[model samples]
Target: MNPVLHAAKLGVLRGWIEFKQMLKNPQEFGFNIIMTIVFLVVLYFQRNKTIEGNDMALAMFALPSLLGMLVVFGGFMGAATTLTFEREDGTLLRAKATPNGMVSYLISRIISVTTFSMVSVIMLLMPGLFLIKGLADTSWSGWLLLLLIFIIGILATLPWGAVVGSLVKSTASSFNLTMLPLGALTAISGIFYPITSLPDWLQVIGQIFPVYWLGLGMRAALLPETAVLAEIGESWRYFEMFGVLGIWTIAGFLIVPKILRRMARKESGSTMEKRKQEMMSRGY
Candidate 1:
């Protein structure tokens, strides 16, 4: 086999093993379970409540949207945080020392992160099917669309995580730059509420980010046709969702390799030691 192909295959195997390890790790499994429970609890409380101007259960409206939000969160923040910590721990430096290691390393990260994100989605979804109504009728096409949106969501957001991870000097800054801002934006992105209810400018602002488009895409996949009544323009807006996410996807692909290369070139034992000292000084 070609060296690159062999490396990629090994990377895939490594990622799967890491993913299994994550499942076995008490802390990791606990975190996922906690998040799943928190979301379910919130949705449970919303079960009887109806959205303004619509009788559909708010939980039903929010469940798939939350799944969508999870995609962007897991893809971007997960990647950024992972990269930042691993960089601090010299994982990237070690990868730089091996033949075709960078490629294998990146592939493993993409696989692990993507699969873990999907596992989270499933963790939420399995219980969600029992907790939320109106989802029971989702057809084969809906499932396909949901799968496609999940894939595109990863493609759209993960590379941006890599970019932010490369640019930020620390995980603290990574969270400040990526997760904090995203959490704020998600408030207006309509994961838990209707976008149409927001001010016109906020609606416009919300639409510009992947979080909103992702929620909209997931809702389109899981909700009934009548649910469109609550959306902007009263349609699925498939074209717009794909168009915006595609732009992000393309831009990230074009930008990340150059950034990663530059960041890799600057990696050295001294730099790694400096980061370790900084992290220790911060009591991390």
Candidate 2:
């Protein structure tokens, strides 16, 4: 068998195994539980409220948008932090020692992040079905569309995540690099509110990133047609959503491998040990 193909299979198997193990890990399991509770709590409070122009409960509006954000977050933050930590621990170094190692590593990250995000999505969606009223009516097509968004959203964000991970010096820096920017984008991206409510320039800036498009795609997937009235141009603008996401996806693919190659070249036992020593010095 070909080396890359064999590596692909190995990566897939490893990714699945890691995902299964994640549920058994206390910290990972607790994150899922805490995330579900936090989202549900917020949705519970919003159940009584409605989008300003629409009869849809704010919680109903938010749930899917938050799901979209999770897809992006899982791909971006998930890959970045994982890469940064693994690099510090010498996992990347080990991978770099093998044939087609980066390919396998990238594939595994994609699979792991995709599965983890799906679990998080379901964790929120299951209770959301009971907690939020409007969602009970979601059709099979809506579920399909949601899945499509997840796939696209992952492709759009994960490479960039890997890029960020490769550039950052440490896991702590990865969080600082990813989180603060993500928070700012979330504020303007309108995951909890419609972008139509944002200022004109902010709206343009918001639409430039994958977050807004992912949220828009989710809303299109799950919300009633009438909800478009609250969106810009009063339409779903599926063209723009895919177009923007496609650009990001293409851009990520073009740039990530080069970045990863450089990062991997710089990875060695010494680099890993240096990172460990720095962490020790900081009492981490």
| The best candidate in terms of lDDT | 1
lDDT of 1 by residue, 176-209 (tens): 9986889888999999999998999999999988
Tell me how many clashing residue pairs each candidate has.
0, 0
Can you write out model 2's per-residue Cα lDDT over 118-179, one digit (the tens) per residue? 89888988988888776778789988898898899999999999999999998989999998
Report lDDT (CA) for all predictions. Answer: 0.92, 0.90
Worst 10 residues of 2 by lDDT: 130-139
RMSD for each of the candidates: 1.0, 1.1
Q: TM per model? A: 0.97, 0.97
